[model samples]
Target: MGKLLLFLSLLPVSGLAGEPVALSEKTYDPSLGVLIIQVNWGRTWKCGQFEHAQLQALTFTQLPLEGANSVVLELQTHSQIAAENTFLPYAYVVQPGEYQLTDFDVAVAKSKKEVIHLKGAKEDMAKAPQSAGTFTIQPGEIVYVGHFGLDCTEEPFLWRFYIEGRSEFESYIAGFRQKFPFVKEVPVQFKLFSTQRFGNPYALENPTVH
Candidate 1:
């Protein structure tokens, strides 16, 4: 009977091999004052034979300033269009605080001497760098959303800034679209937390690969 049963077990199994397993859920909590920068490439937009491609939504948080002071956000736009040619439109600056939204008119100010019109225009202009646009992040607050772009050129375009604050830095990234009109709609959140004592538990529990 045992030999007869072994002879009858020649049929194939039902399912195939090497099936994919479901991935687990993950959560990330970065250290306080840590700037998380994310960059993505977008669809290329063209102008005649020349191409005007753009880097989409390079997002990051400005680390909180230690002393009682303001921070400057700068965007550099390198262009193929010479200075002699009509100035090609490039970048703009945004200063986000606890209660207000200020937009700096980068188009108007071509030179360092030109005024930057904003709520705290005088203070912002005073701190404005000689080569680029400037906006002031008020004390006790964080900049939520900021954007600027450079024209197509062989050289790379760079945008950089600093965050100013003392104690706990608040994350103002919630509902950024309603706050800043120029920012394109996207799923992004910038959080400000203290990096001194405790570690980010969420990051430890769920690590990100790459």
Candidate 2:
């Protein structure tokens, strides 16, 4: 999908066939599958676009298409319009295949200071990366992949990304269904698992391609 845009190129590696992709409801076609998900920066995005996130999508081989990591090609941008739970919706167009969230970027402060969190960020550290649980996407359907949130509640604040559960689905999906009438007839699945905060969002690791 040439329309895909990769915002921040954090690292350099071998090239991939396709560029990263993230689409809006206006740009989505009825033929392709629609993946709708959301993320909360934990706090308000006072700094605006400075706080960035780059999601990569890899081929079935799971190899680093761009470099060491594939791309999210999902909703990496924050919505000026907030949804339920102060979350932002990301609508991604995906081909039929296995996809993974190998790496993602999140902000720790009010500024656009981003930290790259590799799935297995630091081998030595006991904390594992939050599992980007698996699921499938069928053509012309809308899939709700649950909500992901960043919470820095501690005194100094630790950036953690969590996969919120179904309790939130009803609230979010209910609101989403009303906003995008196009997806009203589409089938949806609520299979969001424990995409817990495990890996070191603050640390970086050497790139190791599959």
Candidate 3:
């Protein structure tokens, strides 16, 4: 009984106190990296509509590529929120290497209820112009790419999309990390391809001067 009491006393009285500190040390695979694709658009209609439009349809028609073949990575939409309150899509557990962002599409509806039906009827949803971009990943690093969707505030509402350059992409990742504390902040350099799908047009987009 004396030995039992000694062992018990050795245990830290505040056992749970260390949990948050332990969790602060985020764990990541040494051989893998993460790729986040952010799609920011007008959630609220410019019209007098109070409720924001629902993202009815969105998908990577062409996912990330390692070389000539598609990389085996699981893509998740709405992975997390950013400082600007934008939802982001990400590819998780990606092997450390260079990858090209191939073709992608997104569709938005006025209401969440309509989005459900629009998902099944993809043909019915308005799609953003497809774009191709690229970025690299080092072991235990996280890289980001940006695609913008602009929903104009007038009739015949159209959603226009284009890839953002490197500086802009870096700025976004920096802002995102400020709000999302869980993601380990790793400096990343990205390249977006403009002309030649995979081999030709890949480099980070420069932030526009506007």
Per-residue lDDT for 136 in model 3? 57
TM-score of each: 0.22, 0.48, 0.40
lDDT of 1 by residue, 44-120 (tens): 23412323333322221222322243333322223322221221111122223311111222222223354222122
CA lDDT, candidate 1, residue 30: 16
Reference-based lDDT, each prediction:
0.24, 0.40, 0.36
Per-residue alpha-carbon lDDT of model 2 for 1-210, expressed as tens digits? 011111111121222333323544554566766665555533333323334332221211122334454334533333323322344455565554344444444433434454444232222222332343344555666665544544333322213232333444444555655665566666556533223442232211311111
Kindly state the number of residue pairs that clash in model 3.
Answer: 11
The RMSD (Cα, Å) of candidate 2 is: 12.1
Candidates 1 and 2: which is better by TM-score?
A: 2
Compared with the true structure, model 2 gives a TM-score of 0.48
Top-scoring candidate (lDDT): 2
RMSD of each: 23.2, 12.1, 14.9
Candidate 2: segments with Cα more than 4 A from true spot: 1-26, 42-85, 109-132, 153-171, 193-210
Worst 10 residues of 2 by lDDT: 1-10
lDDT of 2: 0.40
Best-to-worst order by lDDT is 2, 3, 1
Select the stronger candidate by lDDT from 1 and 2.
2
Residue 127 lDDT in candidate 1 = 39
Candidate 3 on 1-210: residue-level lDDT in tens?
A: 000000111111111211101111243344466544434432545323323443333333223322354453223233222223243433344556654333333334445455311222223211311223334566766554434343435421223233345454545555545544566345544533232221233343443211
